[model samples]
Structures are given as structure tokens and as C-alpha cells.
Target: MEKARGVRTERIPLGKLEVGQVLTTTLLDEKGQVLLAKGKQITRPFLERLKARGQEYVLLEILEEVEAVAATEDVPLEVKKKTLEDLQDTLTALSQKKSASIQPLEQDVRRFVKGVRDHREVVIPIIQLKKHDDFTFTHSLNVSVIAVFLGKFLGLGEEEIRLLGLGALLHDLGKLHIPQEILQKSQPLTPEEYRIIEKHPVTALKILDEYAAIGGRIKNVAFEHHEKLDGSGYPRRLFGRDISLLAQITAVADIYEALTSDRPYRKALPLFEVVEYLMGNAGYKLDEKVVTTFVSHISPYQVGDVVRLSSGEEAVVARLNPILPFRPFVRLRIKRPDGTVVLSEEIDLSRSLILTIVGEIELQSQIQVE
Candidate 1:
């Protein structure tokens, strides 16, 4: 269930809705008029009306009583906060052409990657709790965090992976050159404005060259992160062999971060939607191998997420199977009218022929088996 805080919204079947779950997003009719406003508690009559309207499922916010969702907190709060602060300082100094030694910051990023490697989350939110209007630095951190996993999954050597991590952090350094008005504009830009935007990769690369001590491969990301395999990307517009492995890796990370994070223009799309876009655009626009590897690590729902299944049953995600991220192991919550005690049980969604998670929800009561 999504909440007002850092929690993401949960999509759930209408049938599993309790009598009074609070809505997070508004419910609309086919014509787009508001059927139910956000923050309204569900009721018996409301369900009947929705049933008559042929509504199947709804997105509801997490209730107040439920524990704050924490699967995405693999990076400790202290580490995440401090890293963002450090990255901001680093980027600010670089943009201003000040002398900045980023060796310590690079080490911290590598350490964060190692933590991700050990804990192994599937589609967990990165630094979701902390809010910052200036998202560029955190966006860089997210891209690097993601790049580490993708690099490892592709079997890159440790030194290469470390370089990739550093590259991810510095990939967007050029954006600091753009005027804040253009960079943070919430509307479509004119052609002239877009041309300036296209210079970021090259600009970032040059700044890195002048200010920081970084790997040769690390600088490639600043140059080629936006280049498409088909020669459609900007700057030099080099294609195929022209794009380096680290840049290609950074490209995938860059796109995913952009799609998931809130921008000046639009709110972040759902993670599942972003994954679909990546998978759909694999070969021509993005590196097919890298995109596939990153998509494999995304879980449609996080653990501790309560969801409704296709069998008219409700369950909580017990574990995420990396091999089958969508089909996570779930603990089914069975409610029986006979008043018999229901012992808890678990199911591996990948092994079950027909069972699948359809939507996520929050129960009215935080009920659990003792």
C-alpha cells in the first residue's frame, strides 16, 4: 500500500478491499470524472457501486497502522544521507571549477555497491525516504548503485566494476553547466534550448578531465552515456564499437534512474512501467544485454508488500526470487467463515502453474498469524 510518506502505492484487486482502506490515488470513471477522491475510506455501498461500474482493481495508500515499508532501505539512512550530501558537494565544486578530491566519495560509492551486492534487493527503492528538490546528485547516486549490479551480473572484473561505479557518479556532471531555469523547467523546451541540453555529456566529460582524477574508462560514460547503439545519441553520435562497455552500462543506469525519479516536468512513473519501457526499447535505443540484466533485478512488488492474487486471495510478499522477480514467494492470507484457525503457509509463485500476484493491497488490520 502506498502512503503519504516514502512508501510506494499498492495496486490491489477491488474484491480484497476491506470496508475502510484509505485511497491514495483518486478513482476515476471511464470518462475521467472523479469517482472517488483520495483519502476517502472505503465502504460497503462504495464497493457495490464500483462493482456495478465494472471496476476490477484499485490503487490504495498504506494505512496509518501498518509498519513503514522498509525493504528499500538496504542502504542505511546515515550512509545514504551523508553520501547524497557528499555527492552534492562534489558536483558543486566540480561545476565551479574548484579543486575537489573525490577519492573518498568514490570509495563510499563502491562500499554502497558492495552492500547492494551482499543484501541483493530486487527493485528496492534507493533513498526513497529522504526528499531533496535538487535531485541531480541523488540521481547520480542511484545510477551508480544500479550500475554496480548490472556490471556484476555481466561478469565484469572488480576493477572494471569499480570504474563503472565511479563513472556512474560522474555521468551527469555536465548538467551543472546548464542554466538552472532551463535545467529545471517543467515544460517542453524550444529547439534552441534542447540543443543546449544535448551538450551535457560532452560538457560533463570535459569538466571531469579538468577537475577530477578518474579512470580513463570512467570518463567514457560522461562522453557516451547518451549515445545510442544505432548512432542516434548526441555529442559525437558514434555508434556500435564507438560506444564503450562502461558507457553502455551507464546508459542503461541513466535511463532507469530518469524513468524512476521525479523530474521537474513529471512525477516518476511506476517502476514496472519503466522496466517495460527498457525491455521494449532494448536493441536500438539501449544495450540489449545490459537492459535485460537490469530488468531481471526489478521486483514488481517489494517484500513486506501485501498484495491480492488471482485466486480471490490476499497475501504478503515473503521473498523475491531473482530468477523470477515477478513471481515472488508469498505468504497467503486465507480468511474462512468457519472461524477455524488458519495456519500460515507459503507458496513459490514460479513453481505454481496458475498462481500469480495480480495486485498489491493493505489490510484494514495488520493481522498476522502468531
Candidate 2:
């Protein structure tokens, strides 16, 4: 591969760009006097060929360009701390009863809660890591992180946050005894299989009850996380006030995690879409107050996410409003022909525009699916 003096291209993709390498047209100099602005990753041979043909390089910055770079390097410090704690929690929860380490487990719970309380942008990395594994144990870790983060953000005390984290982390421990075939099946489970699966929470409660330190707290969440406010849920459905606050919080966190997770039968729904689904199920299947607080912490628009606008301009979510989760600040990534992407101007949709996010783009495929 050849190099250009003025343009600096990363070696990986350019060295491998094939004969018919496709390139998107991000800019066009109709004015001819416009200064050449740098585009995001262009092939070295393409640049050389363009220069040879006396054609100018039209600068086309790619969406998530900086994010792509960051993923390959070291994860942020807070993320590292949270990750270690999550891993430790998962390992401890999965070990047999005799091997359960109490002191380290308690320390991990405290550290995890502290990490979530310290940082606002904790969900994406935690969720991303779990998505790579997506195992039952890994899912528990993700749920715990989100639960504690939401709890702290909602002004819950540190002790409550720690209890919440530990409870969420062990909420589904009964699944450890489940048959792998039933859990890993790609198709819908039969009625018999579903019945067996439904017994997991009860089994989880029994297992938690065995542990002296975490037993009572974990039992509350494990037994009642599936129980609904209307007494419609399974495992001896209890109504309203009978369910503990710990149970309600765990229930909301469980539902949110399950919806956003890629399951055996369905793909993971985007965060905004999942929020809408939960909102629609309010009062009937979920707690309205719990959902409200959960949505507030997760942020409707997350950074590095690509979304479609009302006017058909696709943009990346840049920043989010703490008070308003439905609306966020965005930077235009793709324009409608003449409308250039103004990186300098951050559009706060909560104040200026009434734009609705249609969907999010998948980072791996770069596909925008609703």
C-alpha cells in the first residue's frame, strides 16, 4: 500500500483495501474554493489514485470514528474497576456453596456500587462486555451494575445500593442448576420446558436461603423479582405492599435487562425502544415509579449511537440531559444532501427541536434496524 504526504491513514484497512473498494461520498466541493477538510478513514491507494487523476479528496468523517479507536486501546479507569468487581461477583456467585467467599464478595459489592455512584456513563461499557458473553452469569453482572447505578442516581444510600447490587447479582442463581439444552435452545421452548424454566426463581430462593450472610436479602429478590404488583406474576404471585422494595427494584431491573438482552428467540432491542416497551407496560406489568427512575439513569440517548431524525437526517447522540431522558443532544453524522454535519453546534433536542429517535445503528454491521 502507498502513503500520501498530506493525508495520514491508519495502516490496517488501507493496507487491505481491495480493487473495488467502495467509498461513500461525504463531501462535494461545488464551490471549488472550499478548503480541503479531512475525511474519516480513506484507503491509501484510493487517495493515490485520486491524486493521480487530479481529483480532490472529499472529506467524509465516519460516525463512531473515535469510539472505534478507543475500543482497541485500554478501557477507561472507572470501567476497569467496575469490570473487575463484576467478574469477581460472577465467579463468587457461580461457585458451589462450600466455595462461596463472603468477605471478598461483600467487598466487590461495595466497590461495584461505588464505581457506579462515581460515574454517570457506566451502562454502555458494562452492557457491551456482557453482550460479548451473554451467558446467564454475565447477564447477572450487567443487571447488578445497572441496578446499583440506577439506585445511586435515584439517591439511595450506599448500604442500600450495596444490598441492591448483591441481590441483583444473585437474583437468577437458580439458573445454574437448569439444563443447558433448555437454556441454550434457539427456538421457543415448549409448554413443558417453560414450566420447568418458571421453577427457577423458587429454586434460586432455596439456594440463597442456604447462604447465611446473603440468604435473606438474596431470597427477597430471587423469590419476588417475578412477582407483579397486580398479583399476575408467577411463583406464588403476591400483590402490591406484600412485595418488598428490594423485590420491586429487582423486578424492574430484571425486566429491563431481559428486554435489552439478546435472547434465544429474539435480538436485543435498542435502549429507547426497550424504554418505550416498558412504558407501554406500565401499571399492568411494571411499576411506573420504578420504570421512571430506571429510564432517568440509563439516558434515552447514549453516546456513539446513530439515530434517524424527523427530517431524515441521521445523527450520532453526543450528549444527554440529566433531567430529561426522552430528549438528548445530538451531532449530525449524515446530512440530507446539502446539509453539512456541523460538529461545532450541539443540538439539544429537549429545547430546540421536537425530533424523535426512530432507531439505533448496530456498531458491528453499521445497519440501522428499527
**Candidate with the greatest lDDT versus the true structure:** 1
Q: Which ten residues in a row have the lowest lDDT in candidate 1?
A: 61-70
lDDT of 2 at 312: 81
Candidate 2 deviant stretches above 4 angstroms = 1-96, 120-127, 132-134, 334-344, 352-356, 362-370
Model 1 C-alpha lDDT versus the unseen true structure: 0.73
lDDT of 2 by residue, 1-370 (tens): 1111111122122224334545442333323332223343445665676557665434333322111111111133454345445555654464455456456556667777666655535232334344333367656766776777767656789888888877887777777777888988899899999888889888877766666766576578878888888898878888887887777887877878787777777888876678788788677767777777776556544566677878687777665544454456678775447876545366666555357676666443121111
lDDT of 1 at 176: 89
Per-residue error (Å), model 2, residue 151: 1.8
Each prediction's TM-score against the native? 0.70, 0.67
lDDT of every predicted structure (CA atoms): 0.73, 0.62
Cα RMSDs, all models: 14.9, 18.7
In model 1, the clashing pairs are 2-62, 11-360
lDDT of 1 by residue, 191-295 (tens): 999999999998887888885467678889888998888888899888877899899988888887788667788987876788889888898878888888777
Model 2 lDDT, full chain set:
0.62
